[model samples]
Target: MAVKIYGIKNCDTMAKARHWLEARGVEAVFHDYKALSIGQDVLEGWADRIGWQKLINTSGTTFRKLPDEDRADLDEAKALRLMQAQPSMIRRPILDTGDQLIAGFKPDIYENVFK
Candidate 1:
């Protein structure tokens, strides 16, 4: 399967994920969403597959720094707008493994997916 790992390059989680993939010899392409913005349609598609709640990284500094108004009463539309404006607020290292979208880095999960 063609795997694509999407995230900001500087993120710590992303670094770990990349390292793990490399160590495992998993051939995957890295997409720097910070430099090249992720599209609204693409985000929408991901949201469709796995709800916006999972795609968003509320615990991250980017999201925590967001104004109270932006964080309040989130729906798909509002969340998408926030994510589009600040890609960093979207969770780190979303691995697209052709057949599935995996959010965040977990060794067990990666092993299962690749195996």
Candidate 2:
């Protein structure tokens, strides 16, 4: 299975996820969003899979720093555009294993999905 992991390289959760995969001898292609931008279609696909709430990182500083109006009533299209413009607004450690798409990195979830 070809596993592709997407996130910012310096993110703590992403680092932990990478370490977990490495320790388990799982080889995954890492796609750093900052370095390689994701297009609107891809973002939409992810949102469709995980839902807007799951894809959007409202807890992150990037989202919190946005103007109140910007965060006020964001729909799917708007959220996708925002995430495309600022990849950090998306949740970290999105894993694509051909057949499945996993967003975020909880060890238990990773263990269950990746295994």
Candidate 3:
């Protein structure tokens, strides 16, 4: 199946991922999470496949900007709610290669998976 990359268009990592896929001539369907809000079921499905921990980008500004209470004692349900509300809280370039769900952009990982 073709790759479906879930990320914002302006993200630097997303740019690299797009370039890498284009260079390899791989078909990529970019699901811009900003433009297209991900459904709860769809997001939950990803979490089920990869785990909610992987879906939440703790290092991103979105997560950091959260109220201290939100960040202090987080759990799966709370994290999922936050991510659903703000896609930016999700890690960049979540790759869906049909069989697996990859949460972030890693050149070496992408090369190994797709090449």
User: What would the TM-score be for candidate 2 when compared with the true structure?
Assistant: 0.95
**lDDT for 10 (candidate 2):** 92
| lDDT leader | 1
**Candidate 3 has which clashing residue pairs, if any?**
none
lDDT of 3 by residue, 11-93 (tens): 99999999999999988898999788888898899989999999999999989988899998888899889999999988988
The C-alpha stretches of model 1 lying farther than 4 A from their native spots are none
Better candidate by TM-score, 1 or 2: 1
Our tally of clashes for model 3 stands at 0
What local distance difference test score does each model get?
0.93, 0.90, 0.90
Q: After superposition, how far is residue 85 of candidate 3 from its true place, in Å?
A: 0.6
In model 3, which runs have C-alpha deviations exceeding 4 angstroms?
none
Which lDDT value does model 2 have at 39? Answer: 79
RMSD (CA, Å), candidate 1 to true, equals: 0.9
The best-first sequence of candidates by TM-score reads 1, 3, 2
Residue range 16-37, candidate 2, lDDT tens digits = 9999999998899999997889
lDDT of 2 at 35: 81
